[model samples]
Target chain A: MTKPAFIAVDWGTSSFRLWLIGEDGNILAERRSGEGMTTAAQAGFANILQAHLDAISAPLDLPVIVCGMAGARQGWVEAGYIDTPTSLAAILTGAVVVPGQSRDVRILPGLAQRAKDAPDVMRGEETQLLGAIAADAKGEQIVCMPGTHSKWVRVVDGRVTGFSTFMTGELFDVITKHSILSHAVAGAADMPADTTAFEAALKAAFEKPQLVTNLMFTARSGQLLHGTTAAGAQALISGTLIGAEIAGALSSAGQGAAITLVASGRLQTLYEEAFRSLSLPYQTIDADAAVRRGLSAAAEAIWLKNESKS
Target chain B: MTKPAFIAVDWGTSSFRLWLIGEDGNILAERRSGEGMTTAAQAGFANILQAHLDAISAPLDLPVIVCGMAGARQGWVEAGYIDTPTSLAAILTGAVVVPGQSRDVRILPGLAQRAKDAPDVMRGEETQLLGAIAADAKGEQIVCMPGTHSKWVRVVDGRVTGFSTFMTGELFDVITKHSILSHAVAGAADMPADTTAFEAALKAAFEKPQLVTNLMFTARSGQLLHGTTAAGAQALISGTLIGAEIAGALSSAGQGAAITLVASGRLQTLYEEAFRSLSLPYQTIDADAAVRRGLSAAAEAIWLKNESKS
Candidate 1:
């Protein structure tokens, strides 16, 4: 029987996913829930972890490795940050042990760019970056991890030079739900996305990224004047935001730096369409897989390799 | 007592300001209320107007000239729009009279740029432009009316070549109120404005308008990493939005076009500070007086001159 060697968890701001990994480094059992850092702060992170461990009837002494906001200042424990420009491999060794835990539990540190002019911080994405890029990767790489706060990281010779966080997804959610444009996109949730409108807006905003806000207004005015459908309005908003994001992300990038998009599902489709519309080339990496690989690396470095040596 | 020739009303989305104008082109009496288009739509636009009119003990035969959202399709009456590439004076002739009213009531038409690529519409600001710029004025002028939906009009030889509406103010409102940044800027309402942060962010966003969204995230990150205050976070958001707006507004303007800023109170102060910080020369116009002058123009065209001729 292949026994579970360790536990791996990705505990983000609003989501939680765990996997019991065997000695072979494959996922043997899994648990996913809404008990992320936000919820866990109130529900008790240890109790939640124990419940999940008991659900799979894992060994009592099995070690666990966690990443994401669970290590935030307000989360279960403060894992702190590893300042850039640092190697991706540095994060694996920066994992902070969860004190007073029944089992050996560790949470990985985040990445922070403390430049006075362009300060930035990211928790789980640092781990994802570690898994997405090889430790010995050479050349310039522009890695885009799109989500609520989309992160665009500039890496050279496997070192994180800097990164920018675009409030793309969070802005979209607020604008569509709370702004006057809310009226323009009210009934577009169930309808198929208007890709034509999306492509046009994406191209326009990419070329003139400064007019992004004005372009957003067209979602409402276009509906009022040209009778644009709700789906078209929604698509226009999404495309405009994502387009400006891409332009900004690449504004300071090295010429011909390989664009690596780390995303999955709807964001993947949208970003890929945006890049294709703008004729910008990019390679795709599944975000879920990348984060898992990152956690696994930390797990192996912290437990598996140590056990084998012992 | 000066005879009240007509009433000039700026019936906007959330505010109502009416000036009883005498035949001498002076305000005889004034009334202000929160019963704007939104509240008036539910309470009945006619009743709200009548109450204000009755409060002043005005004659039953007094006529009314209204501008703003009251002329919107969802307002008092469907006043329709005068398409762009037309003279500024064209709005005066496009007023639609409300039928079945006790007194004569006219709603001025808004300006609409029907171009497919950059469709836009403005309801009340056309009248403001009418008052802000002379009919026979020559050369190029860039008129910026900063409000909920900031309007930037490009006028060449008194003709509105085109305009764009930047969702700067509304985006700021929604982002600060409903987005994750809300936590960053909490309790900022009473705090004094952080001019230092505002100027820094404004300059940054202006220089790299494409990075507006990314710049916005720095407000939160700055707070977390550098212990920036709530006031600073709020200022950063405001400055970024306004800076991006200014960059986009001037993207296609003629070289050295005169910048005319029509705003009042807080908005006027903020925009003036922004222009000064950017070292952009601009002339100021009082928004309240401009709208009044605009509505008075419509009144003279629609009723006063016609009645005098009769």
Candidate 2:
């Protein structure tokens, strides 16, 4: 059996995932929980990690590699950020070590674009980008990483030129829960998703994204005027937001740059439908696999490869 | 003392304002309260309105004319809607009287655009439109009634064309209060308004309104990357929403239609600033005066003018 090499973890603001990798890059064990940075900050990151590691009975000496909000300022140890226009390789080298750990533990830094006109930052998606796009790949590429704060990164050759963060997911959450439209979409979760409303709204918003807020109001108005289903209202809101995101993401991107979407589950389904509705050709990479691969690459560079060389 | 001709009230979703108008069209008495439709729905609209009427020491027989959410389906009385492409005169004739009221109390109907592709409805603002624009106003005119849900109406040759509703204000409220960026704007209300930041964000979003969600994220990223103040984050979010609203409202409007703004207090100030920043010429009408005038017009058509004719 291949010996355990290192543990790769994705610790986001509200979620935690850990994987024990073998020497050959095979996953030996896995664990996921809600004890992300927020919970860990209160319960102690070290104790949570130990409990997860103990559940899998992993080697005590195995080092751990982490990314995402675990490295945020209010996170575990403030892993900091690597400013753009920097190479994906810079992310691997900027990992900050957690001092006095029983085993070697490091958190990958995020990327920040400090442009006055269009400032943006990403904590975990940089690693996903690091793995999603090949380091030596040529030509311009637009990589879309969708989540609570969906990020659209512009990659020129191997370097990350810049990126923009669209508050699509969080906006959807708040608007549907807190706005008057909340009443329109109250029973949506129990109903089947409305792809018809989704596609139409996606097309309209993609064509005239400035009218997005106006379009959102239609969710309520549509219900009142035409008895639109609660599910339709929910889908309409989602499509309008995602449609605007896609339009904004490509607004300044080089024409014909390949669109690579990195998302998982529901977001993946929605974005794919949006791309198809807009007739934009695109490719997809599973977000979980990409992040694990990115973390694996970082682990090899930080520990496994170094151990072999020595 | 001039005899009270009628009681004009603008009873909105969350606020109530009443004015006792004299026979010669002057204000004889006034009252304001938080007992809007929401509260009055539970406390009883008749009781609340009568209490205000009694407090002003007006004669018990003075009839009341109301326009706003009080006319909504969920409001005190379902006064219903006058579909678009009808004359503004139709609204004056559409008032529904409260059946069991001690004196004449009529609620003005809202406007509804039942277009399948762009459905919209507005309750209070049609009355504002009736007051803001002259009956024989020639050429195309665009009226903006800014509030929780801002309404932009199009009128051509004194006929009501169509309108769009943008959820800009509610979005600002929810986003700043519930989203992740809420942390970025926690103390913004205590800080001085950041007009500089507001203008910069306004121009950016106005120029590329599709990038609104992305621009909104900058509120948080700006603080993380450049130490932008809480007030600046608040202003940035506000600017982005308003900027997108303006762009959406005019995307298909006829070029150079006279812009009339009917808004009061803070919204009026902010919208005026936005128009100035965009170099769009516009004239302002006090929202209070417009609504009051509107109610008065409905009263004259319903009772006063009819009384004189008799």
Real contacts recovered, all predictions: 0.89, 0.96
Q: Give chain A TM for each model in order.
A: 0.97, 0.98
Per-prediction TM-score to the true structure, in the order listed: 0.98, 0.98
**CA lDDT of each candidate?**
0.92, 0.92
lDDT of 1: 0.92
Question: How far is each candidate from the true structure, as Cα RMSD in Å?
Answer: 1.6, 1.5
lDDT at position B85, candidate 1: 96
What is model 2's C-alpha RMSD?
1.5
Score chain B of each candidate by TM-score: 0.97, 0.98
Supply every candidate's count of residue pairs whose N, Cα or C atoms clash at under 3 angstroms: 0, 0
Report, for candidate 1, the interface RMSD: 0.4
